[model samples]
Target: MGALKTSKRSDLKNCLTKCKLFRTDVTGSRLYNQRA
Candidate 1:
């Protein structure tokens, strides 16, 4: 049970990181477009 919980926590962390990266990518593109 402990191992399962740890794995789930790691999965959540990975998902959050992916979401943050995606958001940054979207914002970065918008800024680039405005500058261009």
Candidate 2:
């Protein structure tokens, strides 16, 4: 039970971070290309 709870929490955190990173990556590339 404890392991499952911890894993679930980490999974959610990873998901959030992944989403943020993906957004940043897309925007970053767009800005970089535009400014270049």
Candidate 3:
């Protein structure tokens, strides 16, 4: 049970990181387009 909990926590962290990266990518592209 403890191992399962740790694995789930890591997965959640990974998901959050991915989401943050995607958000940044989208915003960056928008800014770039506006400047062009």
Candidate 4:
């Protein structure tokens, strides 16, 4: 049970990080497009 909770927490963290990265990438692309 404890192991499953730990795994879930890790997965959540990974998902959050991925979402943040994607947002940053999208923002960067938008900025570059505006500049162009």
Per-residue C-alpha lDDT of model 2 across residues 1-36, encoded as one tens digit per residue? 999999999999999999999999999999999999
List model 1 lDDT by residue over 1-36, tens digit each: 999999999999999999999999999999999999
lDDT of each: 1.00, 1.00, 1.00, 1.00
The list of candidate 1 runs beyond 4 A from truth reads none
Per-candidate Cα RMSD to the true structure, in Å, reads 0.5, 1.0, 0.4, 0.2
- The collision pairs in model 1 are none
Per-model TM values vs. the true structure: 0.92, 0.78, 0.95, 0.98
TM-score-based ranking: 4, 3, 1, 2
Cα shift from native, residue 18, model 1 (Å):
0.4
lDDT (tens digit, per residue) of candidate 4 on 1-36: 999999999999999999999999999999999999
Writing each residue's lDDT as its tens digit, candidate 3 over 1-36 gives 999999999999999999999999999999999999
TM-score between candidate 4 and the true structure: 0.98
Clashing pairs in 4: none
Pitting candidate 2 against candidate 4, the one with the higher TM-score is: 4
Question: Model 4's lDDT to the true fold?
Answer: 1.00
